[model samples]
Target: MIETNVLTITQLEHRYGGVTVLAVPFFELARGRHALLLGPSGCGKSTLLHLLGAILTAQAGRIEIDGVDLAALAPRAADDWRGRHVGLLPQQLALVSSLCVRDNVLLPAYAAGLPADEQRAQALLAGLGLADKAHAMPHQLSGGQRQRVAIARAMYTQPRLLLADEPTANLDDRACATVVALLARQARDANASLLIASHDARLVAALPGAAVLRLPARGELPCAA
Candidate 1:
């Protein structure tokens, strides 16, 4: 039977040198829903995001994305699957300094061995109000513009799930609100499930009604904050 959920994690655990850094008994994010993974630094929020994005394999337990088990994929197949179905917005916004905005947005398609869809890239840029900046290099854009470019890149593939890691780091209140709104709007438009990992309590209010899963610092009990 096909799975309706975009993501399902069961008994997920990751460790570094036998010290468990992240653990989740069970979690599910329904398709097209927005959820937040909230916790303090070193509480494994990033680790969880990486595991879900297939950047780091879980040391134990099961992860199913649309009913396909993550551990079942070979390395190459995992990369291709991630590129095609998972949209990642990492905190660093790792845009290629040498590539222009448009090319940067198309990078995922190239990496996935998919044809470059220039039309989709253009639409995403325009939607983010970055149409005129398409030819500009990363350095030419402001911090917020750079963030938007990263978001466009993540959304360019029209991924089934969008995962953001600390997207609001270092932003002021107004900027944070803007960024959160943009992410939500884009995710809604793309019909993709959204999962944001953050330590910011401001997000709890900014994203009212989003499912909140508060992880604990190591050795503490997990509860929603």
Candidate 2:
């Protein structure tokens, strides 16, 4: 059976301060599958994730997430759409250090004018082995633990699309496996499509039938971002 496209891109062009970041002519992500975007640093992998998350506006071309034309939405509308259907885990994790782990997970829904479902959030955290850390602050957790919290936060809303940048960069082989497993399971449970940008070979190897997007080296035909 042919899976419906969860994300569709055509002639996606993006620039930052006059430097072209992405010039990918075509790309598509099928629903309920996990895809790996592989490339070295400065390869525009993260930039592409950002665009998909609607964090950055495309300079040209079309971006459709779950059949909605992203480029056509107003800035506020785009942000709302992101909160509603897209979960972005940037390289930084971007957790609010001041909030407890569970609160951080619930923040997204709160921002979107949706009621927080404590049961669902707790279930996701528990599945990630973070049930005991519900009240722990971000500063209290280890790197892997913090990363898991970020993942839980992304999965809390049951988004249709999940975009992660360098999700396993800091994890060891075993930890990487654990993280990928959790992400794959959650994405499937949520009926969401996951796109991850990472340089970690182990992480890519673990994903089932992952599609790779490798970027040309710097100055190699001026590969955009």
Candidate 3:
């Protein structure tokens, strides 16, 4: 039987300033499965992720996650939908530098209007070896540690679908492997579908089976018509 899908996109076409960046005839991710979107930089991988994560509406095509067609929902409804089911780790890691470690991890749950549970938050941070840094600011943590904190924040709310964009760019091989494994395990335990966009082949090789989405090129300054 076909697994119920967590996210799906059909004939997606998006452009920036009239320059076509991505064109996917079809893309689908089954519930609890993981996929990797790979390509050179500027190939629209990030753009595609944004669309699926509900950060941007597809300029043309259809996108559905957890049975909800994002295009049809109002902005407020879409935000609610994302908060309840989608977890995103953007390229920047996007951690608030001013917030203490624990507070940063708990922000997602707070934003979703869910009651924050201190015990659960602590467990996640500790599991990632961040227990001691619970009060540390973002600037105080090393790059690898910062990335791990980002992962914890994403999983804190136990979302049904997780989107990670260039999550391991700053780490060394060992650190990269550790982070990848942690993410896969977390997604599996939460029964969440994970879609990661990265240029790292090592990461993709480690994932058992991950679909890849390649992007179009950035040609002559004006690009071909």
Per lDDT, the best of the predicted structures is 1
Candidate number with greatest TM-score: 1
User: What's model 1's overall lDDT?
Assistant: 0.89
Model 2: ten consecutive residues of lowest lDDT: 216-225
Which portions of model 2 miss their true places by more than 4 Å? 221-225
- Residue pairs in clash, model 2: none
Where is the poorest 10-residue window by lDDT in model 1? 216-225
Off by over 4 Å in 1: 1-3, 221-225
lDDT of 3 at 179: 74
**1 versus 2: better TM-score goes to:** 1
Q: List lDDT for all candidates, in order.
A: 0.89, 0.82, 0.82
Tally clashing residue pairs in candidate 3: 0
Among residues 3 or more apart in sequence or in different chains, the pairs in candidate 1 whose N, CA or C atoms overlap within 3 Å are none
The per-residue C-alpha lDDT of model 2 at residue 33 equals: 60
